[model samples]
Target: MSSNPGQEGAVAHHEHESREHASHEDAGIGRFFFGHVPEGVHGGLKQYGLLAIFLAIITFVEFVIILPEDLRGSSIVIAPLVILSVIKFFCVVAFFMHLKFEHGLLWQIFVAGLVLGLIVAIALVLLFGVFRPTPRAFSEGRQQPFVHHVEEAPHYEPLVVPTPAPLGAIAPAPAAGAAAGASPGQQIFMGAGGCSACHAIEGLAVGALGPDLTHIATVAESRVPGQSAEDYIRESIVEPDAYTVTAADEGIDQDFQQGLMVATTSSLGLTDEDVDELVEYLMTLR
Candidate 1:
């Protein structure tokens, strides 16, 4: 039997329409999940795979940058890490989130939200004085204090305490002067206080998170007007935000953010005597 040409044509056209409908459905689903793709761009698995690789490479670089202890401590390392983070953030938002394909009101809304968030962040930092630094303390003339070191002996000497004399017995005379020894403040700073974790003191603590305190004693007196060095140092230990130190004060090139130091003395479990001793020892730095 011979087929009709018009009937054959009709069947072919119907199959064509079915395929077109399927294609539209697939595209719609893609747009719903992965977002709309801009013209001239092949929003395919291959393109997304490449983007994933790029993001992975950036993350690896960031990880490697902080792997070294020296680089971790240097201020120069912060900028690159921040830049990479921003790049990653932008890429994820623009491509993965399909924000780049959006236009008009959507873009405006996004930009406005970003700006408002940044403003709020900056305001919070200022209100909390997180980056605020006290005035620089300049030292004009000051002498370095003497540090006493005792010679090593085979046996350690025991501390002696005077006993009360019997009713009829005579009391022993006290020694004229005590022997010079290591500073108690130095012991606490190096051992229990944990000041060395963020502060650097030449030949002692080697922390880089905070300012260098090699000559803090010489500059302490000049930190606050009319405030004595002892008072300033004590306040700094108990209330770290009372006087924040800048990168310039630490002789560094970067801007040292304040509030990185722990704000309370209770955090260090320091007592009034420990604070006094720590201040006294720091005063001897000059």
Candidate 2:
């Protein structure tokens, strides 16, 4: 049947309306993902070049402040560094990541995560001393003074000692100078060894996760073939599972299961020099 001309016109109008609606929907989606750059946004960005310059300067200052050795352990240095890091983080989030234009819900989620992390850190500081073990005076290596030292050698000598030598002097008479020979080892123990954080002995400071190892070398030796006491300790730090002494055997109450000590080869990024220092210091535990 032939359609009336008016009806044909109405059908064409409906089709045109449908096409227009589709076009509007498509435009809306495009705008949501790729925000429209205004006709002269480039000019506005040029005007905002000062913002970029200021940000660059801030970054440079942060780097310079952090690079100086004197800034280490200084509140003056740490405070600015933290502030710069926070600023940088926000800048990237706002500009590069476009978080500034994001919905409030997303921002809330991000802020919540940051707050939670800070809370956990504070809690750790209260409970476990900032997620760091307390440094022991004497760690797996190094000897302390006034501790019971019963030797099982042929003589079975019992040497009662007073306070250790001054921080600079050697306790025993050794050919190697105390300060010069043991300096690297001490640095490694404090740095790479990750000691001096928790445990405390009369002379040395080491993490308290384990026992004070003052005279560990003299008191403890390796039962395994081809392994010295020094080797045993180093291996234990690198891989705690390679050797395991029962808590009862070690005269400790806590029984260490598998995977107790976290491997820090990746985290601390120990170099050969660092390892050597650590080994040298550990051997001096006697």
Candidate 3:
């Protein structure tokens, strides 16, 4: 049967439009991101430009957030920064990286790799306890006090206080300038306390991560204005988040982190006396 001419023309026109649409879709992300389209020429440039501009705006905002006062220690900073960073990562990879145009198998591989990398990074950070509170740095004079020490051989045992016993049970107080028979506090510091890993108490712990406690007592009284040396030392042990050791000019003050030292203290089941001995030992550092 002969088809109507009008109907035939209509069918052809419809097919041409379908082909044009498919061509546009197949253009890929590169054309969307970098290809310049002539003004008034209809293509994906407008869509691409909008998305690109959006990503740019996000980056600019991240920098702007840094300039605001109270940026540090702000409750709202974490979520916004993390969420924005993730969004930017996705946008860049999906469009700018052309992952959206890749085959399904390749796309899945890229996605899996990204997730695995994040997992490994988080695991390593946790394993090393970097997320825990970091101790402040000790920046005092070059002179160090001479103290005889027990040889730990640079090995640190994970702190394991079996039970939170009464203060006297941990260890009795040592005599002044006691050089023999290390106390329970010293055991905690070198053995399970993990303080030795970051602190250098002259011939004792020898840790370089934290301040040199060799003279911590000398300046502890002056460090906190009106606070007593004993009080400052106690705060450093139990509440590392309370103070921050920014740089070398801070004397014996240490860098502060949120849960690091708290986790350490809590994990050890330190009793009142354990802390007392630790404080007493710290005071002798002068």
Candidate 4:
């Protein structure tokens, strides 16, 4: 039997409507996780809901990257997180805050504020020495950038601190072919160990992230009053939180993510003897 064109058109339209209704109902939490917005869902609620889903996905991915050891302090990780958050910030302002639908002038003002905030955040990261190039000395006294391969603050293995003479003992015997006066501890601090990344050592390195170690040997004992300079320095490396070194230059106690240094070292995969050697070299920093 031949179908009537009008009736067939009506039946097709009904099917389309049913499909659209199903899609709208499926725009649940699962859709949010995958960021699949329903085409049929329109109007203010749908638009804002999809934007919120995107924001949530970005935020969750950022948190996942941050919780891992290697990515937490990495600029490769940090830069993306910052950028994603910026996008989410704009979405919130535009949709939820109605900036997108506001007067042109009002939205421009809001966006200008956002630009200023982003610039300030970037400046602060730079001021904190997160992206600055730092010089590093290797085992053979060859100098290179502290983080050569990494864009900024990648996972760094402790410089291989060779066995050195004990802190209070005579100069230890170096391996037959070692660099003269370039003890294992010295190598680790200046080279693979990454000390020079955040510290400044006289005639050695000039890192700006942490307090200068030029006179760390001298001040180490006095800072804690009763702790030996050697002990204090070791504790500073192994337990930095034990003493929060205020940025006396700035006259403020800030909570910088500098804790990554301690976190990295705690699992530095170095032997006890190697650590002792590393400490010995720092003790000689005066």
Candidate 5:
């Protein structure tokens, strides 16, 4: 029941003509509608049209989602704006950034970066925000008195003073009085407050993640705004947001987890006394 060779030739020619017609239509569309496109662009140009339409819709939504005049005072506006921004970001990344057509490894890298950013952001928010860790002394109550005993040096004797006391003369005190009395609290603070972790304090040298604190007190007081030298030292330790130290000091904005100061109080444990001692020591810096 095979067809005649003449009939088969005629059918093949008809099919070829139909294919040529479709190719001509596609060529016309590409030449007229997409003349500005670069030569390497292939069949993916249709996706560009979809992207344009999607972006237009997103723009319209962004403009039209304004709060009502009556409800403008409420907090609902913020949530919607954040959600919309995220949606817009995803759309732009997937389409305009060519992530949708990218290799799976590239998409994985992008998502990993996004997640890392979010983790860092959340950590910083917790570190600097209301969840901020209380310093050691504050947690134990500032009024709690600390009693210290004098440590006797059994191996040595005290040197005697020969001169009699003059009128209204103050006697020379033990050299280690302040260190012996306050050393314990300062130690607790240095360990918990994260000061030693960032700064290099000679006596309590820990990690040197931050600036050297040897002469910070002298340097801070000379700044332009003329904030109290003691106040600057105190605030910088207890509340980092009090003053942004710039110029020579530049790590102020690096709170995100991806940055160096990643292990903030939210992730690292810090006690109230730790914060207090660090604040107190910083105050003495000036």
Candidate 6:
């Protein structure tokens, strides 16, 4: 049987139409999902594998950086880790999330969202004083003064009158006035002054947020060229930012961060007497 030319032309036309329709549908789907990908930019399996390898290497480096105790405690390790993390984040978002292939408007939106999230996180941290150390109460109530009890003599000697010695012996200087105990300054330190929040004293306050004040009195005079120990202690309470402490100064593992202490004594509700008491107590740490 001979084929008809008209029928053959009709079949060919139908096939062409079907192919065009399928092509249009595929192009529409691609635009919907990937947005407008620029020419010559392709994310294939090989590219993904390379990114994965890069990320793994970064992770390994981060792990290695934190292995040393001293480095881990210092900002030298923290800063590099933060930078590496940000790089990894961008790589994942641009390639895996296809943000790089998408429109500029999507990128703008993503960046705005990221900036807003960071602002909120920082605000919350400040509001909650997350980095500030909390003051601890050393005792529930005022500590009792230590008293030395003297035991009664085992047996009283029978009454015997001895002649009194001649006057002007000076009575041994009244036994040096029986060393005074537990000053009001100590109370303020453990209470209103909030000194225990950031400072540490060997057998007293245990706070570790700021410098170790165990020997603050001994070192205070040398901290400034002309400042006395009492003056230094007083100034530290009134104007905390006047001088900053470092690891070298304190012979410690890490330096105390600046601006962590309350800016003013008023913020702590410390009166002049309270401050004085706190200074006195701290000076006695030596």
Candidate whose TM-score is highest: 6
The lDDT of each candidate is 0.62, 0.54, 0.60, 0.60, 0.51, 0.63
Residue-level lDDT tens digits of model 3 in 1-286: 2222332232222223322222222123223443423222243466579879999999999887767777754867777888899888877776665554333345567767978998999998786557653333222333344447865445434543233323233233322223368776776665545566556787764555555677889978787788899999999888876765555545444443345556545666777787888888788788
Compared with the true structure, what per-residue lDDT tens digits does model 4 show for residues 1-286? 2222332232223323433333223212222232323234344676777778888898898888788786678898889888988778766765576543333456557557868998999897786557653432223443344755567655545554333222222212222223466778876776556666666777766555677788777777688778899888878777777877777633545443457567645665667677799889878777
Q: Candidate 5 lDDT, tens digit per residue, 19-132?
A: 222221212212232232222224457777887787788778766767367655456766776787887787677556655433345666777898999999999878866486
Q: Which stretch of 10 consecutive residues in model 6 shows the poorest summed lDDT?
A: 170-179
Give the higher-lDDT candidate: 2 or 5.
2
User: Model 4, which residues run further than 4 Å from truth?
Assistant: 1-180, 249-258
Give candidate 4's error at residue 108 in angstroms.
Answer: 28
Candidate 4 least-lDDT 10 residues:
167-176
- Any idea what lDDT model 4 has? 0.60
Error of 2 at 130 (Å): 34
Q: lDDT (0-100) at residue 129 of candidate 5?
A: 62
Best by lDDT: 6
Question: lDDT tens digits, residues 1-286, model 6?
Answer: 2222332232223222222222211122224434433332343577889889999999999999999987676888889999999989987987777565444456668778999999999987776556553323433233444446955544434433223221122122211221145577765654445565556677665567778788888989899889999999899878888998888987776677787675423465667887787787778877
**Estimated TM-score for each candidate:** 0.38, 0.33, 0.37, 0.37, 0.32, 0.40
The TM-score between candidate 6 and the true structure equals 0.40
What's the lDDT for candidate 5? 0.51
Query: Residue 225, candidate 2: how far off, in angstroms?
Result: 5.4
TM-score of model number 2: 0.33
Looking at model 6, the pairs that clash are none
**Deviating ranges (above 4 Å) for candidate 3:** 1-180, 251-259
Q: Write the per-residue lDDT of candidate 1 for residues 151-187, one digit (tens) a residue.
A: 5543534433323222122111111111135577876
- Candidate 4 clashing pairs? 158-193, 159-192, 159-193, 162-184
